[model samples]
Target: MESTSLQPASAPAGKFLSRFLIITVTICILISPGYIFFSERGGIGFIEGVTVKQLLHLIFPFFGLYAFTLVWGQIIIGTCKPLIKKIFPGIGRFHRLEGIFAFIFALIHPVLLIGSLGAVTYLKYEFVGPNKKIFVLLGVTALLLLIVTVTTALLMRLPWLQKRWKKLHYANYAVFILVFIHSWNLGTDIQGSPLQYLWMFFAVSAGLGTLYRIWRAIVKRRTAMSAQSATASEPTNSLNPPNS
Candidate 1:
């Protein structure tokens, strides 16, 4: 009999190229922030007259970009199951790690912003003032939702919460939307640079992923309902035949 274990199976032979590509891509993502930082700082010539506070401020955008990438990746993985299974069969192992790192990078981005802007200024929110910072408020709301989602995900280990956590985790979709709007309006690094194209790409891809997920769910539900109706209409087997 074939084994029915829920554990992910090992990658098949000839999948080495896929594994190599994934690792190479991950390495590039990990180092991209440093490359962008130096390139933005006048090609390594920005050390002169640059203060420690200025450095922290400069680093915040890159961190936010990294976090956004990770979140976008999660959406792609969740929505494109077949593609991910084909490309990197072992990716399931690192799914939670990806989320954790995304959260860490996300948390750091705002902290660094606060470091430069001061907590009082960073926390200020005015919807109808000349000094209104609605974009900042949106970013703050996204971060708070992310915190709640991640907390519930971690608590899912408890028997009582295992079935209930997914409802809270769905808040991540809202988080992504809020973050996209927030960054589009307020992100300095992506506003007028080539990075804006990259940001747009992530947003479009995530939007498509969400649509695909919704379509798949609808199809699955329809298939299940059709099968159930067919089963209900089948004639029942009886020990004695009925008179015609």
Candidate 2:
């Protein structure tokens, strides 16, 4: 007899390394577009009138530092599930931790971005920047998603909020797209580089992967329902066995 929550070990390849690798790979693919394209512009390109080299000098380190952190986040979620499970004991809570980590990273990302720009703006008055208000609003929305997703991870903490948190987390997809669009609109350097194409390639791949997951989930649900239905009908038909 199999328990509902605990399954036989042979159910599937639920190994920690496998899950970690998949999640890490997915997140890397997800972040690659933004990081790769945004990276090249350097510091001078970001600042209003600095030469490309100067901007690169100022900006590259900050960018590199964050990229290092971002890659770690991916690896933690993708490859380190076993460790997480060891620490947390249960699947749901462990899963929530993943969301929490993602939220933390997302929160830091925009803060550093805005802070860096603010510093630059204070340092020089080379050009009037675009509507920082709009940028901030979009950024805040992204941050909020991380916050909400992290909050929802407490399934036992707030059961009613579980569905809501999940729904809010879905907004991350929207946040990602908006961020990219905002970057494209404001990314002056992307105008002439191959970066845009590469970004698009990664973005499309990530989106398609998400869609693929959705489809697989739906198929699994349908299969489950059909199998249950068949099992349920077995006894009824056996009593009066249907005519051939």
- RMSD vs true structure, all candidates: 5.6, 9.0
Q: Write the per-residue lDDT of candidate 1 for residues 90-199, one digit (tens) a residue.
A: 77656667878879999999898788777776666422254437777888898999898878777888998899888887888888888888887777667777667777
Q: List the residue pairs that clash in candidate 1.
A: none
Clashes of 1: 0
Model 2: per-residue Cα lDDT over 1-244, one tens digit each: 5575567563444665555775687677556645654566552346787655455445533342333233234333333444455533575554555556555555555445445466565235222365545644554565565455456555535767755765655655665565555445545444466656754664665566566657767988999999999999999888995679
Pairs of residues clashing in candidate 2: 20-78, 20-79, 24-78, 43-55, 43-56, 44-55, 44-56
TM-score result, candidate 2? 0.53
Question: Of the candidates shown, which would achieve the greatest TM-score relative to the real structure?
Answer: 1
In candidate 1, stretches whose alpha carbon ends up further than 4 angstroms from where it belongs are: 1-34, 47-49, 125-132, 235-244
Total backbone collisions for each predicted model: 0, 7
